[model samples]
Target chain A: MAASGEEVRNMQVILKDYVAGFPKESDMNVKTGSIKLKLAEDESSDSAVLVKNLYLSCDPYMRGRMTNSPVDDPDFSPFTPGSPIVGHGVAENLRNSSKFTLLMCPFPYYTGILGMPGMTAYFGFYQVCSPKKGERVYISAASGAVGQLVGQFAKLMGCYVVGSAGSKEKVELLKSKFGFDDAFNYKEEHDLVAALKRYFPEGIDIYFENVGGKMLDAVLLNMRFHGRIAACGMISQYNLQQPEGIQNITTVVFKRIRLEGFIIFDYFDQYPKFLDFVLPYIREGKIVYVEDITEGLERGPSALIGLFSGRNVGKQVVKVTNE
Target chain B: MAASGEEVRNMQVILKDYVAGFPKESDMNVKTGSIKLKLAEDESSDSAVLVKNLYLSCDPYMRGRMTNSPVDDPDFSPFTPGSPIVGHGVAENLRNSSKFTLLMCPFPYYTGILGMPGMTAYFGFYQVCSPKKGERVYISAASGAVGQLVGQFAKLMGCYVVGSAGSKEKVELLKSKFGFDDAFNYKEEHDLVAALKRYFPEGIDIYFENVGGKMLDAVLLNMRFHGRIAACGMISQYNLQQPEGIQNITTVVFKRIRLEGFIIFDYFDQYPKFLDFVLPYIREGKIVYVEDITEGLERGPSALIGLFSGRNVGKQVVKVTNE
Candidate 1:
């Protein structure tokens, strides 16, 4: 740990203003601020832990928070202008100032597989979809943080999994690395409904929805009887001023399909339980995570903005410090 | 019973062709045909029962069957040109022919409170919505067959029930006859979302969706946290070539709402249990059903077509025979 009276430069990516339409790199600015290494005399010792954020997670749902209204989630406050944007990050404990030292021990894994995205995939796939052995699962945005984990988890459960991504590299990674049964570049498909029908001839039983809009509309057309859709996020619709309308939603009635939307905040209590289920897979090399990481905090604005354009191949992470 | 050799004139309604947009009265033609009163020699006594049709039900969902694809439901076959349209009806058994006489004993109640609409309201409200006592419930198409029953059932469950109709008379009937806590003529409301907010300031806990399109979009904005939406039918979209898109569907995620669609065919096994729960309510006049009877089967075409324009006052029924 640094000396008690030492001063440190804290670099952060701050929001310029409330974003409209697609977010541009210029919407964020990297600013330098100073912080004292030592705790104040009056500060509570048992409640707080000093952390040096090492890896900042760049996720699609963060785009929703950039907007002034944060229209999709009423509980989420918008990013304050000229302030450091808050998000999930892998942080290293600098000082033990809390009684719950055990809780702070796992801070390193808080941005990746054992973090918000991991819990999202766990609760979304197992709890929401209720997958059975040999059931067919289809995932959108499958090369991203949550999707990659969902695909691997589904495979571990002995289910057939197919994924759709935006680029050829991501598609190849899904099949070659993640062990997906089939993978497709959704950008190349002229007709998404036809593409989904071609891939899932028997129809999809469980759909892990990440990218919404046209994808959701097509998935609705290809759902099997009593199919379940775990609506984790709608990254495709988040940037649009007026989100696309779903035309074939009536199929929900005929197929007896259940489409439910969820956020990871509600499933935080299941973190310990999720780790128990996933740790073995990670340790045995049965599960793998690919991250698209950029060096230095200066590249944070572009790294975060690149998510909307499908520029990142895997989990986009901004590496702030080596320690 | 009529003599064995007697030939009776059976008035039938036949579709001219698969309808495109709105169905017109001319799309269906009423014609008279003759049927032998007695069963054929090859017809098994245990397999068939002869009955006289008394009342024919005219429902909004039938509009879906008028299309070429009937994309919503594959089980429902489109009306074949020059063939009599088949639907749920009140019938009187003339001959015992079958050993299962007890099952056919209640045929008279098949077109009203004990039939399709009854089970729809029962399962959609009780099973899907899972309403709690003192919760706020809202019903669309309030004066229609299933809607009226749903309103009454919610009231019986000790819920604060409100309903929306298309006309002043229907709105009055919802509040006075059906005992809805409050009623509104939606056609008079300039802004549906504002109107719903005015009625349900605390937000709606259950929304029995009978009409889709703009109403559904508006309802999404007014739903309370963890609200349940029983998508019984989308009457507004049935006749249109393109169904209206719902813009505020992401609210499902923010509010943690569960929107479920159901058809009564899936709940037939629960019919006996439904009867046990509902029969007493009807006996004591705790539940009352209103029928808009159009005399003669010749009026069936006009009565069925009238559903699109909100022409029928209640459960539109064609009184084909008195006895």
Candidate 2:
């Protein structure tokens, strides 16, 4: 069995080792591996479609996959120690007769709003939140990929929406660009629980929990009776050695609150419906999608790690190739 | 206005002050106060109904009511420091023409298994857990009023259920009486997370969270993908000045677990449906109802305080009168 193909240098971001605390750029290595653009007759199979990777999504959830997962589920399993990182990415099928094609993908946008993150915001908010016309909604990590979309969705539903971000710029983006009723810099707040009370005098009806720990505890304190929490992501706890305990958790019973956690994979079957709804929102400028993109695959580690520290303004993406 | 009906001795348990940590028996002052058995001749209102207290339900949620609650909601508002404690009670209508009538009388059982705790277990398990046959279930505080019924419900559903209690007796009762697949004394297990893993090697599909804090943190790690948690109460945290931070809360995201908190007050409308479901089980002896009943209302302080430390064997009830 002779390997016969046109060999090309494929640049890759390989996981150097399993991460412990916060992931640093040093934990990943930029490696150039040779791969055949076209498969030989001997190796060609009906299912094997070799592709050229264009863009990679750098999400906070990737932090979990960086660690050696105990469970063997493919969706949540860890990245191999010395392999090209596996994530939500946009790829161009190298084979001319390829069946694998992303639908109406403008590659970068596909990594954010029009991709997995888009469906996440779609079902996580509408289905999980069960939003009413005049409900109050508070989104943590509001400038990020999912939060921004959720905020916009809440606004479209005539909700009083408030979002919190770590930085001043992201906070501004939430209000000015994403159409949040109001936005606050979480970093500036001394007492987060009290801060939420000030913001929600009547109390929050829906809490889009993105940053967990103190924020979640605070949100628990501020949530109104019969409030709904879509437990989407907990970026704050991802890198921590010890995750924070929720004090006001009992308030859930007192208030009859529903805190539901969901993954986008489970709801992927409904992606077509989400696209039907969101594509129009994007085309008509009803929703704003922002991306903080890094130019090269080599910068993937930094871009992905930046999400933990609130360095990425919106959806973090690594542009592997333009081809 | 002159007080008219025959005045009788109303032995009452009053909160001495707002509690800080674990409540003491001294915090509740047993006072012999005089109360009219009937509405005064001058104060007969069309809506008002006078009743003689028969039995009192001493539940864990009362710990929250002992503290001064910020929210003004009557269902959860704190008891006045010097007033008789407000809680679920079985009362006989002094006026023969009273509309507020108990559908079925047996007062002691009505205070527990047939009343609020019964409804809590019924809806909390059936509605919130979304249980399926042969699914794995775990319940913390499994020998208590609500937990006991929930375990029985799980067994009836043909699910493999494990329960944890603070006492060896309760553990025995869980396995022998309530028909739990397995039971453990959580106090004996130094490592609750490892204990849970040992019991649930495959992982938990449903977690009935009664004692929160460290127990909840452990349950999070043990939850199978798409697990549902009915956050009934956090009796453990109610005594603590600082609630223990849940370290594995991020597992809620990884496992896509749903942690829902509810009160029986919201589900009162569903009581008729619950009665239809559970009354048959109780009558057939398919379910066991345990009660650690105090002889008199004077002993209410000790019995109520006993719940926090897992002192009550089952439903802690104060038999105010046999009348």
Candidate 3:
């Protein structure tokens, strides 16, 4: 560690160029640059805090940042070519007194269960779905970060929970590890609509949508009357230049379905309440969280890209640097 | 009019065949059928009430019934080819003490303003949209039964309302008659998304979706953060075997939008409350309902088909027999 006001070598994962379709590892490069360490005078200092990024979140939403068009939120703006990529990350203030105190859970898990993804699962399921006991629930990308948690939450509510994942292992994880009532490998299913019909003969009452496109179309076709769909993310669609159209959208009207999309940024106020609800679940071993971690900042691009192809088993995170 | 236990000739609109694409007048034929008129001992009697049909409603949803595939609800099941077409109609008990009392509004208006259409507008705008005062609202198929009421409801809440219709006459009606803040002819605009952007420069806060397909795709792009879409009906998509896909649905996630589809049948219990709310509005001239009344039962096919082609100016109703 460099002393205060001393010149030091800093490492960052830089976006080499703007991405068009599926992002490759060549799109980013790990580079070392010089930085001068400085301590801020007060807690609310105007100057930037020199933070040692402990963990970097590899989320699918980051794919929008890699594109040419800027996202609406300035915080999630387009990643400039030849500049550092930005996303949710766990960082400790190295200049002075550290600011973070994640007492309830391990700091590393902040990139997965204890962070934005956690809040997303909590609110998206409870608030948006308005889930009732004994209701049928289905989750797409079932073994992933948000999907797994939602499936568990549905199970907790006495719901008949079914999930779909791309790989056999993820499907098994959803059933055995996450306690989903039934799980299937979406890749193996030739007819998704028929598959859903088989799993949910009564029809799905609530669908936690993650992978949008054909999956969404199938889910729409299988939804029961007065069904609710909580749309959190669409990883499969992120890399596409022109997203595939959802053909069975008319079913939403006929079946009287409610499809609601929510961003975690809007529900940050509920974080404290979410922590109160989920902390006990985590402590009691009721809610189990899985993660796929990659070491070093250099692997950030590949880790994030893995999300599009369903390469990541769970929450994908990169360990930037040790405290 | 027929007396008790009397055999009489009944004029009826019969479905000649199941419809495939857009419904034509040839799909239905006016026929005269024989019926035995009778009266029940009590109001709750199991025997059917022999009544003279006064008015028959011509709604776009009726198109679904004309298809070979039976809709989910048994009440809205597929129309049997070569059988009498069934729909909402204003009738009076001709064989006994007349079971009819519409003191607040005209009995004929029950086919449109004072009944299902009014209730659809009430719940869809207030409950589904959760509209606030001064929010921007947009309505597609704005000159129709439900759309016109939704527009007026938004205006009553002090919202800035814009409407889109298929004709120049309807555009003028939306602005001058229905009191929409701004109105446009969607058929004139080659680029719907750009047209919506022009009208809703600040982005649409509420979208009362009636016409679906590409229009819904355009509305999806122009919605504001935390926008609400009350999907009452999708008139444009019902005729197609394969409904057009909805692209740009991902904006719902980034913008935290809520899109809810509702059936008026689900809100039937709220009729008395709806009457209390809308009756005053009608009496005070705050809410004006327009009707396009066709004179004879034989014209039912043409009147009903006109809804799909946007040939009718307002709520299309066929006066079956004068009360």
Per-candidate DockQ vs. reference: 0.68, 0.68, 0.84
Residue runs of model 1 more than 4 Å from their true location after superposition:
A2-5, A37-47, A70-75, A97-109, B3-5, B38-47, B70-74, B96-109
Question: Which residue pairs in model 2 clash with each other?
Answer: A245-B245, A245-B246
**Can you tell me which runs of candidate 3 are displaced by over 4 Å?**
A40-49, A95-101, B40-48, B96-101
Query: What lDDT tens digits, residue by residue, belong to model 2 across residues A1-323?
Result: 22337778878889989999999989999888887766534456755556777889988888888888667468878889988788888876556444345655467888889988889898999998899999999999999989999999999999999999999898889888988999999999989988898889999999999988989988888888889999999988887776676667777777888888888989888878998998887878788889988998888888988888889999999888654
- Model 1 DockQ vs. reference: 0.68
Error of 2 at A119 (Å): 0.9
What shift in Å separates residue B228 of candidate 3 from its native position after superposition?
Answer: 0.7
| Model 1: TM-score for chain B | 0.92
C-alpha lDDT of candidate 2 relative to the true structure: 0.86
The 10-residue segment of model 1 chain A with minimum total lDDT is: A97-106
lDDT tens readout by residue for model 1, B1-323: 45456788888899888889999999988888898787654455654557778778887778777877744455566777778887888765666533233343344356767888999999999999999999999999989989999999999899999999999999999989999999999999999999999999999999999998899999999998778888888888887788899888877776777888888988888889998888888778789988788988888988998888989998888889764
lDDT of 2 at B268: 91
Scored by DockQ, the top model is: 3
User: Which residue pairs collide, candidate 3?
Assistant: none
Compose the digit string of candidate 1's lDDT tens values, residues A1-323: 55456799988888999999999989998888887777554345654456778788887777878887744444477888888888888765566533233343333345767788889999999998999999999999999989999999999899999999999999999999999999999999999999999999999999999988999999999998888888888888888999899887777776778888888888888788998888777768788888788888899889988998899987788889764
Q: Give candidate 2's error at residue B205 in angstroms.
A: 0.9
Docking class of 3: high
Choose the strongest candidate by TM-score. 3
The top-ranked prediction according to lDDT is 3
At residue B78, candidate 1 shows an lDDT of 79
